[model samples]
Target chain A: MSAALDAAPGRELPVLAVVGVGLIGGSFAAALRRAGKVGKVIGAGRSRDALVRAKGLGLIDEAVALEDAARQADIIVLATPVGAIPAILSRLLPFLKPDALLTDVGSTKADVVKAARSALGDRSECFVPGHPIAGAEKTGPEAASADLFVGRTVVLTPLEENTEQCRTLAIDLWKACGARVVLMEPDAHDAALASVSHVPHFLASVFMAQVSGADDADLRLSLAGSGFRDFTRISAGSAEMWQDIFMANRDAVLQELKAFRALLEQTESALAQGDARELHELLERAAVARRFWGSRSGHE
Target chain B: MSAALDAAPGRELPVLAVVGVGLIGGSFAAALRRAGKVGKVIGAGRSRDALVRAKGLGLIDEAVALEDAARQADIIVLATPVGAIPAILSRLLPFLKPDALLTDVGSTKADVVKAARSALGDRSECFVPGHPIAGAEKTGPEAASADLFVGRTVVLTPLEENTEQCRTLAIDLWKACGARVVLMEPDAHDAALASVSHVPHFLASVFMAQVSGADDADLRLSLAGSGFRDFTRISAGSAEMWQDIFMANRDAVLQELKAFRALLEQTESALAQGDARELHELLERAAVARRFWGSRSGHE
Candidate 1:
């Protein structure tokens, strides 16, 4: 309902189990704890060492097995790679508490939505497919921060079978963690994210590949300034993580990439034709749009 | 010559006239004045109000007519747009004193070299073409910083006819302003710059165009974060300036753009085919290259 209507105000809140206690999951645990919105946080992952580290860092109150945590957790937060989400959801389903509120922080929504539909079945109303549009190049539990999602957007893709109370509980939890929550259809979430996130990452990688593919790449890099640094910065992110994202959001990403390629071809044609006015007009439109967007996003 | 081979030291240096006192030109005047390497710095531009403002900010010791300043200046720095450089050279040729050394701050090299060859003729020995790989989204005299080129690379493309003394003078001046000068052939400079700088600008603009082309662009932009901010930052730069750069280095930029397009196609196909391994490998190569380049360039 409202921000004043806390997820569980004036009561000992539910235990929130964060599976795959890395950046996203760890940050969720830390932020919830920092906000005094949870009674306990459990870390579940394949790596015992990482889970122990997360516990030591107070990102989680304790490290536990996923099945054990799923049986006891009042809420289950699946924060893993997109490709890994479906498998993890299947595993958690058998042990999950009937009243548990399940949510995931994945870049792609469609695949996760499908996973919830297949795995949760009659209990799908408790599962919410979500994506928090916030992260840094560096990852892991050690890199997690309580304010990672503050002032950031978190999109929730609720299924038609989801109960209104389940949806409101998810939103209130995210709000308590200091994020601005927005609702969208699964396909809509994927498309919007493809434009703003997935496609941009691919473009950065493509541009980086072009420069490195050159014979004198080192020489070209030597002359690179802030422009090159900022432009290709995202290309240095984890390749494995991005590969999964590309595959999970394939159709939307492909469509946006096609649009991007078309614009690039048009720009290249203008340059080849020595059409200064045409090139200027194209750049001018992009510049104006970017400026307007940046101003709205407090980037200006 | 070493940086110790000062352009002017211990004695009051000759009058330095900065034609087209905008960002590049204005910064030159400011850095030289800060180093106390000149007796007086004169501002020359078509905009008298800007010239007066430059003088008021002490970016120039005085504001003067271009022809009048050219007649008396010992060193003339052309800081105009690339498209305007040739015409400016033509105008300066008749009024240029034999001993006056001429240099320009243009982004592209080949066109400026051709202009110098055609306009200077036998006097080409006194001209040097340079490109300082330093700038910001902001422009004009007000945005000029004395340390703009400090620790930055400034490539000098001296004509074959350039005298040793003339070349040394240009290097000395740039060195005195704290720029690390690198020698390059005009064509080589353009090609290298296209890979590192020019193509990246176009790519940013193209990506921006793609995002904004969507009907729900505002919603998409609301989800845009730091990665988008950094990736498309260059797209916010002055359109008129970039248009000139794209046109001046048309052939080289087109070549780089083609390479970039091919890479994008490869990446797109990998995603379309759900070839995770191929996508991962491509991204891995790009990530490795970007990390290596970033480390060398202090971007890491």
Candidate 2:
């Protein structure tokens, strides 16, 4: 830490350029500020209104041009959806300083890493891919909070040739936001997230839609309490954002979805046969497993 | 409403007998008293400790023997788990006045109604099988709040033989708790609930368990966030309770589960084939449907 500080002749507060000031970027800025860790936070996004909102909310100290942010800041956070990362990286790569750090908050990373390796060539060493396991169904700067990442896990998938400076700084940024950082391979991160996150997103949306489909819609919505609300919350997420994740984590998302289908078939067969005993047992097992899951996830 | 009130002479303030005193029972008792809709709340449970706790929490005005409650109360609530309804009705049947109102807060009905009808014989006409579509992932008296049913749906499955007295009382009880009451056939109610409630519970449990079976348990849990938690919240529901619901709503639960399975398979095949366009279209539809659900559900 002392060596890092001493490396510069004139000590200036570290600057992190946050691109696409939506839920991830805005919250990243707030979390960094709340911890009193990073020095200067610059907000950048295609949406001038969102950047303004991010700045006014004190999520960032200043609004900086995306290109300038890439060149001047010591760290750059591309907080856009996964599909947007490749194009954004292509545009920002040339503008980035030789030693500047690049990272992303995309949910799916295998595609991001591949895109980065291809687009940035040798400079891929400066890019680190990380995802903070923190979000809500709601979006935009307003939904972002300083405590969003508190006690949440953040996974970083650095390429084999990636520099320690890039990886360590990336880890430190997440840690400063109160996240417990873990390192994993890009494919592993993508696959695990598909099972835990993206697949659930699709499942939730489909189930909610199906329930609302069968006549008496208003009555059904009225019947829906917290259980239905919670079960289907993710279905309301940014459509395009989920599309990006699905495209990126395609293989893994489908794999988990397939497994879920098999389980559903067994449940369906029991129900179709009016085999109350079998249905009861399966539901019981599911309930027990889910109880364990609820307990485990509730505390976190 | 006015006729029933004037007809029943006011002596000793008619007690509202609550048979379970778990989250649902305690919440109902609190809502009834706090809303000034009931004269007294009588709590009953097999466990003396649970009954004592419910009474101590001001969830009930008194904790008494089930027979005593059945004897003293003008309104009786079988708020216990569905499976317990049969035994409870059998034990309390001989003590219930034919004119005294009886209902329930079970999640699933038809079977509970059928079973209780057998127990009470001809007097079962007074026992209305009701299920308030309200609850939290949390359970027990400690988890109870008077506002649990506020602005939520309460489905009352009335039988063809249900007297006007029974239906009116059932609606009034739920309305007192700020619920929007709906009257449906017991079978239809069971079918609709299995699709909207029970199916979601099993899907959630299966999704979580599939990942739990993976080599990395800790990693899986760490990656799960609000989306995963919300989707699987019902998985934490009582094992025995869900078991009973599955048996009761077997036909509908199976049908919904099958539909969910077919969709899940389609999703998987799309991914396996790298058909991003197909996946995108499916997810986008869910996302749109979910947006309406979110506004209705008041989700963030």
Span of ten consecutive residues with least summed lDDT in model 2 chain B: B1-10
Q: Candidate 1 on A1-300: residue-level lDDT in tens? A: 322123455655678899889988998988888887777888887879889989889888888887888887888898877777777777888997767888999888888889888877888888888988887577889999989989989999988988787787889789978999999999998999899888889989988988898889878989998899989999999998899888888999999888877877877877887887888888999999999988888775
Q: Determine the TM-score of chain B of model 1.
A: 0.94
lDDT of 2 at A145: 89
DockQ score of the complex predicted as candidate 2: 0.57
Model 2, runs deviating above 4 Å: A1-10, A33-38, A61-65, A270-300, B1-10, B35-37, B297-300
Off by over 4 Å in 1: A1-10, B1-10
Q: DockQ score for model 1, please?
A: 0.77
lDDT of 2 by residue, A1-300 (tens): 422222344576567789988888888888876765567888887899998988888888889777888877777889887787778888888788777878898888889999999889999998889988887566899889888888888899988988887777778878989988999998888878888898788888667656666676665565666677778778877777887788778778877777766766676666677676776666566666666766766641
> Which candidate should be chosen as best, given lDDT against the real structure?
1
TM-score of 2: 0.91
Best by DockQ: 1
Per-residue alpha-carbon lDDT of candidate 2 for residues B35-77, written as tens digits (9 for 90 to 100): 6667878888787888998888888888888888878777888
